[model samples]
Target chain A: MQQTRTVELGTGLFVFLGVVALFFLTTQTTGFSGFMGGDAYRVTARFDNIGGLTTRAPVTMAGVTIGRVEAIEFDPERLNARVTMRIDGRYDQIPDDSEASILTAGLLGGQYIGLGAGGSFDNLRDGDEIYLTQSAIVLENLISRFLFQQSQEDQDD
Target chain B: MSVLRELGESFVSFLRILGDMALFLLRLVMYTPRGLLRFRLVVHQVHNTGALSLVIIMISGLFVGMVLALQGFDLLARFNSEDALGTAAALALIKELGPVVTALLFAGRAGTALASEIGLMKATEQLSAMEMMAVDPMRRVVLPRFLGGVIAMPLLVAIFTAIGIFGAWLVGVVMMGVDAGSFWSQMQANVSGDEIFEGVFKSVVFGIAASLIAVYEGYRAWPTAEGVGRATTRTVVLTAVSVLILDYMITAALL
Candidate 1:
């Protein structure tokens, strides 16, 4: 009987540890905390080119993640990528005129949308679109354009 | 004529085993609603499987994580991105390595024990004795073990993943001079819920496969010592192969 009690206690502790680990893993890995806490709002942005931007990518405001990219679609009439973002409710003070730029984390890290606040008192609400947007800077395009310009200059010389 | 006869014999046996396994699974499921009422028995088997298996799971997690950190750091050095070592290790452990390794370990550890224990009882006629007493051994013995294994597997995998990340941190931040802040922050920023869910889902499927095979093999083992050994071996082999195949299928579908 004593042995049984000890075994049950041990199993309980083991299971508890496992649950804690899983909760830590879930919170650490994703923007799930914001969604699970029910404290996020949706907004949209339009860029001329999103490059390799993917759905579920983090949306950061001043280095801190506010939420994630919910979806990406092509706007045929505007000829650009339309990105839907979910921002945390706690950070609701984002000005309506704020700029959203696609930025890379490091030299080879993944790209995310970063928000630079504007000086306006008007705040962004759900479904509101941020018009001031910059697309991902494709290094290959810049390099090729630079090469083309140099060759043109050489021909003129 | 002999070669053809042998091929035919093997194929027939294969189908027979498959049929028996399917029926065993059906019976197990049928017993579940009532068997679940025996919570103490399930807890006993949990002790037998989960508690006993913790040491091995933790040891494997640590070593796998250490190896990942070392190898990842070497590879990332070329790109001058050693800071992503934590992310690489965490992602690998959470997404693929943790569940796969834990399931393989469970097959070798708890799975074999389950098969052999039931085989021994059958050989000793204990199961039959229970039947004579009007007690269904399938519910009293088999169901508990099955539920125990299924419950134990995901917990084991969770522990494996957590320990693996810590191991990676030890090797990356404590031993080699990588920035601790970057390692964790990058891991946090890149690792997502979908990847974690992928691992959890894989483990659940593996748990079901491993436990079902273990109990099925045990219950059906020929009532002999040698038969018990063979059944145990079969449990490990079948569980490992199916887990790998299922891993591939799940990863492909999820990704």
Candidate 2:
């Protein structure tokens, strides 16, 4: 009986430890905490090319992440990529005229949306679209353009 | 003609075994409520499987994490983007390595133990003795062991992942001098709830597979020493193959 009790006690401790680890993974390691606790507002932007921008990528202002890209959809009417962003409620003062651009993190890192603040009094509200948007820079396009410019320069020389 | 007949007979035997396993699983499920009522028995098995396996799981997790950090930092540093080490290591551990490795270890450690123990009981006629005494061995013995493995598996996976992340942090930030703030912050910013759910879901599925294979092999072992040994070996092999196949299927479905 005593041995059984000891075994049971050990099992209880093991189980408790496992639960704590699970809680840590969910709350700290993942974005589950932010998803559950924060209130956020949605805004839309359109780009000709989003590059490798994925859902759940960070939306940053001045290098600080302020929200997340909730969804990316194709605008059939405009023939562009429409991105929906969910900004944290605390950052509600983003100007209506701000520019949204898809930017890469470092050379090989994932793509994210960077919002540049505009000098307007009006703040962006839910469902409002940011009109000034820059598409992601395609590497192949840049390389080809560079080569084309080089050829022109050689011809002129 | 003899060789062709042998091949056909083997195939038929494989089908029969699969059918038998399915029925055994159904019976285990039916007796689960009764097994729950004997919760103490289940607890004992949990102690056997979970607590006993903790040291090995933790050590393996730590070493795996440390190795990931070392490899990740080396690769990321060449690009001058070592700050992404935390995100890379955490994603690899959480999404793939943690659950899969834990299930593999659990099968090797606990699965073989369950199979051999049950096989020995059959060899000694203890299971038959219980049957003659009017106690259902399925409910009394097998269900508790199966439930224990199923319950203990996810917990072990969780612990393994947590320990692995800590090991990565130790190697990345402490020893390698990676920026601590970026390491954690980047991981937090990048990893989503859905990815974590995928890991937990995989662990649960693997737990069921590992435990089921162990108990089924043990319960149906031929009542002899060589039979018990073969059953134990088969438990490990089958569980490993099923876990890997299931991991691929689950990842494909989720992704």
Error of 1 at B156 (Å): 0.7
Clashing pairs in 1: none
- CAPRI quality level assigned to candidate 1 from its DockQ score: medium
Deviation in angstroms for B190 in model 1? 1.1
Fnat (0 to 1) per candidate:
0.67, 0.84
Off by over 4 Å in 2: A36-38, B1-4
Tell me, by lDDT, which candidate is best: 2
For each candidate in turn, the TM-score is 0.94, 0.95
Model 1 chain B, poorest ten-residue lDDT window? B185-194
lDDT of 2 by residue, B1-255 (tens): 999999999999999998999899899898898789988999999999999999999999999999999999999999898999999999999989999999999999999999999999989999999999999888888999999999999999999999999999999999999999999988887788888899999999999899999999999999999999999999999999999999999999999
Candidate 2 residue lDDT tens string, A30-128? 754755257789999999999999998889999888888999999899899999999888899999999999999877678999999999999999899
| lDDT by residue (tens digit), candidate 1, B1-255 | 999999999999999988988888899889888888999999888878888899999999999999999999999999999998988999999989999999999999999999999999999999999999999999989999999999999999999999999899999999888899899888887887778889999999999999999999999999999999999999999999989999999999999
